[model samples]
Target chain A: MADVPTKTARAEWGTRFGFLMAMIGAMVGAGNIWRFPYVMGNNGGGAFVLAFLVLLFLLAVPGLMAEVALGRYTNKGVIGAFRDVVGRGGMVGLGVVVLLVNIALMSYYSPVIAWTLYYAVHSLLFTFTQPGFEAEPFMLGLFDNAALMIGLHTVVMGSIAAILALGIRRGVERIVVYAVPALVIALAVMTIRGLTLDGASEGIAFAFTIDWAFLTYSDTWIAALGQALFSTGLGWGIALTVGSYLREYDDVPLGGGVFTAIGESSIGILAALAIFPIVFAVGIEPDAGAGLAFVSLVEVFPEIPLGGLVAILFFVGFFLATFTSGLLITEVSVTTLAEETRFTRTQTVLGVCGGIWLLGLPSAYSVDILDYLDFVFGNWGLPLATLMIIGIIGWVMGPERLRLLAVNQNAGIHVGRWWNPVIKYVIPTVMLFIMAYFAWENFGTAEMIGGMLVLVLFPIIGYALMSVIEGRGEQPDTADLTGGDD
Target chain B: MALTAEVIGMLAFTLLAFWGIATWSLVRTLRQEDRKVEILKHQDRMDTYSPESLAELREWIENNPNDPLADEARQQHNECVDALKHTDMHYYDWSSEEIDRLDRV
Candidate 1:
């Protein structure tokens, strides 16, 4: 591997607050607000929450920490960091996997951010709050309108590109420093308002009440684990890219990884508080599935006092969370290009965002495309990639060495030897089982095959071709084990 | 299990406490960062020397190698040079071929 630079000029978090906020902002996306509530509600509420917490601590946090450590220790993006950690050559394939997952995620995710932005504007305009409002038709019309979808998508992607072009501290940190606090306060206010509604308590009961029956079902555990992983942005290389910018003194174990996980998981609960009470108060179903936020909330908003304003605030918060998360995901791709290829940050942003915008066209045009991409990447691609990452860290790099070199090195809360076994054995085993179950359930579908071929196989082949084209050359000396001062 | 008055009260309290802690933590960290920013600004001034000034300092250190301030000035000059080199290195990008070659070693 190329030697670690004796000095680095990479951008860093300006403050601990900025770093933590960015991390939380990256983790607590619209998924936490929408997906988590319905999933928790569907999977026995408190029981699922319990499983999710356990998995977050046991599997997700360690995976996140390992990624962060890889990024910080190597001071490289996913591809470069992988090469640094596990020598070079074919490790490029692993990098490709990480890069492709983020890119694929961004393709579908950005459009959703656009949708949130659209809904936020729509709420402000009182489009849906008008008398004789029909939410289904309104949503259908919005989704079917390719021009509007693409316009909003362009706007969202363009804004992200603009922000990223300003560099890390000036752009990402500054935005998240304001956006995350705003998101939290908005959710808090919404929760307070929602709680004041009649019958709101029923929703809270539904959310927190445990149905022990779900504990017997393996699917519940798997779903909870998946939620935790996706919710915390594990296996996505975002944390890894974010970690690449960490100053030497930034704590990884406690403040960086653990605290972010805690903060993110709390947002899920907070979202449930903000959402469920309003849903029950308006007599809408808590397990309204994916439509809980978009449809159900739209239906209920007009019934409540000052619902129009509340709707605007909620969607604005949703947009901010998703936009920030999208920014981080896009950064992974941007950083890779800027570091690995002959692209400056500005050129990389243009190339990456333009590419994602084009790729997201089909998703913008059709719900099927979006769902297909989400199913493939979110369900299969992410889990598989995450498993591969942990396996690399645990087996290839030696979990104990990673612990000493990455986790415990400059961390305030030193990870113990227990981390080694948990990462090396327990996490991988759980991940493997989840992947297997998902594959078994999803394998025969045409969408699965097409997605695997397009998303998974195509990337691997492209990387192989690139590697061959590049050819092997003289190797640089091994990086100095002593990480240089920033 | 029902959402009684106490349950509602507990939920509200918990969320309030979470918001409180998050706000407090953010405020504390931002305050600490303000102080760090002041120190960093000063350090930025000390660390940054113009290339012409650095060249002169280098010449001065070479001429007065044994002078009391020679060691300190030389160290500062070297640090500035290193920082410039680091910045230049970051500005340039590596090709896939170069990255592969680096990985091989």
Candidate 2:
């Protein structure tokens, strides 16, 4: 209501394939390429995959269906979508909570993407295969060099800003359609290369051997749960933002929910195939974890056949993975801000990208700062955002209404009553449990305190801001839209 | 360590289940979109809801006449019914009898 501009016609994906690719491109980031492969290797491999797959279908699929359906139904960005559902009040601030979390996440995330970009460029230079290339010094050289990290972070954000400035179809879709498939091909080639290496079969055995006993471990399920949700980027307002641009008659459940979730995870499976064999082949620690493994795994690339080329493929593909996610994560803010305020898309893109780059400077300056922020936000902020999104759908907007109206309207598959409770009950419960678990695990720590701060403050800020804003005159009458079957 | 048959079998199943299902979903949804485009090109409008979904819409509208979104729901339900009745070919499975039986909710 405060000096809002007349709205422009919304953009739609130029093609269905573009939409699907965007979802996959956004979801399959460093998590899929780096973390997923090793997480699978360490977590009883086949048993973990089974549990992860089950959780993906059970939670991620339905949660995404609801989120995307809300977006398409309202045809608006996060806050605007919230305004439509919750009406004109401080309550609309709940959407603000989502926006804040997304921005915070993207801030630290830009620096990480910068790491991938640096590695990708190095890969192209055949740096990893250089006889004198020392993995620790190379990685440390990049991490410790504040100027280089900042420059890379600036480049990543600038690239993202430039891409997002082109709008959904021309900018986002155009890039993703190419970037996603390229990542797959790179991984596929690496997989084949890894397989032909001496002792590569040991890698497969390590990754594929079923430890059925893992199914009985609570830790295994927890690990699987995190992998499933994190890899899919569920409830991150990402699916919602992407879903907002869905063309009329686009099916939400099949494309947005099923394909997006599974397709992204497929890349993880491919990554497991791509990386594990090589790690085992060269005798690196399989459980070195994502960060250590990433640095340690680099030395192995040169030790293998076609090592230089494989290095290029892995890093460049890794760059694209993180780059695409940076694009969409930034888009969540651009899309929402463009609609909520008077800013044009280009203006919004610059403002958002500039803000993120500025905030990311600290993280880029120090690896420890980046890790600290990552731990705090990744554990808490993401789930809180998820809870807000799915909570609104389940409680306020009503999953039954959403399924009946938007989800099933052009759904490729029928979503029955079974989907309703999952959206309403199961997801919120899981989110609460995640937060509680993290809080307990990190008790008395700075990370836990930072998380606790985000949990408490973000909603209050959102609510207070909305209350003041909505108190202004000449707002849209959203009364009828507020309550549903729930 | 040599790859045992158990490891080999598990690898195959994981690939088929994850990559196979993903590939299948991708093909199916893209195909569905193509079919929707084809049908839309032939007619001014295509049916928005599948038969099963349309019926659910009808049932929901009937049950929640006073619901805030009921009017929109009814309108959507009827739009599908109209498209199914008017279009020569349909995207979702619909029998001749079913089309004949369909009316505005």
Candidate 3:
């Protein structure tokens, strides 16, 4: 009798392009569009770029490679990955640490996506071009109207939930392949338009002028470090979760590490080109904060030629950037819970999105709550997740094992021994430094206190919860901790 | 206002470093994927590791035979060796002499 082939029902990316696009879409958020440009505008523009590039190569590149390799090597989501490494005990709680942080981040981030969605709709209406329109009051009106904010938040979460319910190929991959390219093209068009404007060179000079002094300043490095790490969404479990769905014969190092690290950040450079030239051309005082995108850019839209069309391109692209991130950020939880629980994918989507929406209410009701959570999570929670994931790969599983097993397996570019030390020593050290530096900078403040609480409380909560479930030994551990297992 | 040569130079450097490298990696990886798919269509399986990486895997398996992942690594290394000997086309550059020298762990 002839044996028939049996294909597993496992959902993988339909194509390599879909997987690549998903990484870019998940990493390039509203921060890449606005926060990066904002920081660059303030720091010596060219100097900041120099600092950022150095750190990106040293830390984010190798670090991301390690994170992606661990995911592909294990082919599991956060918690399962931890169990695979640590032999199915309380130590598996480390994965829960990552999951909790991912959810916490999405809770506030979903509301921010809602903000962009609101502006994207208005930009479609050419609201920025309306007579007697005020950018400040327009922004304030949205921020102040709690009902509208909550409604927009609900809408954003609903859209994300609907997309996620479709599963990986039909859901996330289908949207990102189109959305990511559309985002790049939109920014590219805006960049061309901005560059051709009068006084555009002044904006360019303001942004690209290398003050050699900034390279000497610690503050410049600090700003660049923050932009490089946070802006790339390193550790956050987004990359790991995305990496988990990698198909057989997929290369992790090149696509997941090099391409993703540099590719998503390239959008930030595009953003600076798109926004600053337009701002200078209109003689608007450049504000290098979140306000620049929401308020300052809105003001400039009325003054430029074909400004209404520009508004459409910028806001729509901005919405795509944040919305895709929202989808993936929430997917980290959806992927993990769906694995751990007996629930269906559709059920997981509803449960995760509902939880995010509920946690997001306070953030949705007020901008202050959003900013507060952003600082806390951005400073401590994310680095903690990074520490957990990279720490496990570095110390527990051993970087050499993962590198040989996954990183160099069909890798586009060969990664040498240099990556091991970076993963083992460099990344964890940098993560610790980032958390400590931020704490020292904001010492004794409420934000600092909140960050401290997260650092302490999250691990305790994760350990206790996992201990109760796993200590009972309801299932066999079956953890393969051969070579490199510490 | 006239632009300084320094600012222009910085802008050029940043653009080349970010977008230039990004475009290169994206194109290269996608091309690699295409090559892999084409190879798999012809052969049941393609070589999973390069010469250097396969050697590294073999060395690792030899050095740490007791490691939990050693069996998996050895299997991967041997699979690549088998594919190299049997397949006409290869993903990584491998000479017939190199294929002859290969052995299962």
TM-score of each model's chain B: 0.40, 0.94, 0.95
Candidate 3 lDDT, tens digit per residue, A306-352?
A: 99999999999999999999999999999888888888889999999
Predicted structure with the largest DockQ when compared to the true one: 3
2 or 3, greater by DockQ: 3
Ranking by lDDT: 3, 2, 1
* Pairs with steric clashes in candidate 2: none
Query: What are the lDDT figures for the candidates, one per model?
Result: 0.74, 0.88, 0.89
Q: iRMS values in order, in angstroms?
A: 12.5, 1.3, 1.2
**Candidate 1 lDDT by residue in tens digits, A55-81:** 888877787888788788778888887
- On DockQ, the stronger of 1 and 2 is 2
DockQ of each candidate, alpha-carbon based:
0.06, 0.81, 0.82
**Best to worst by DockQ, what's the order?**
3, 2, 1
Off by over 4 Å in 3: A1-8, A472-486
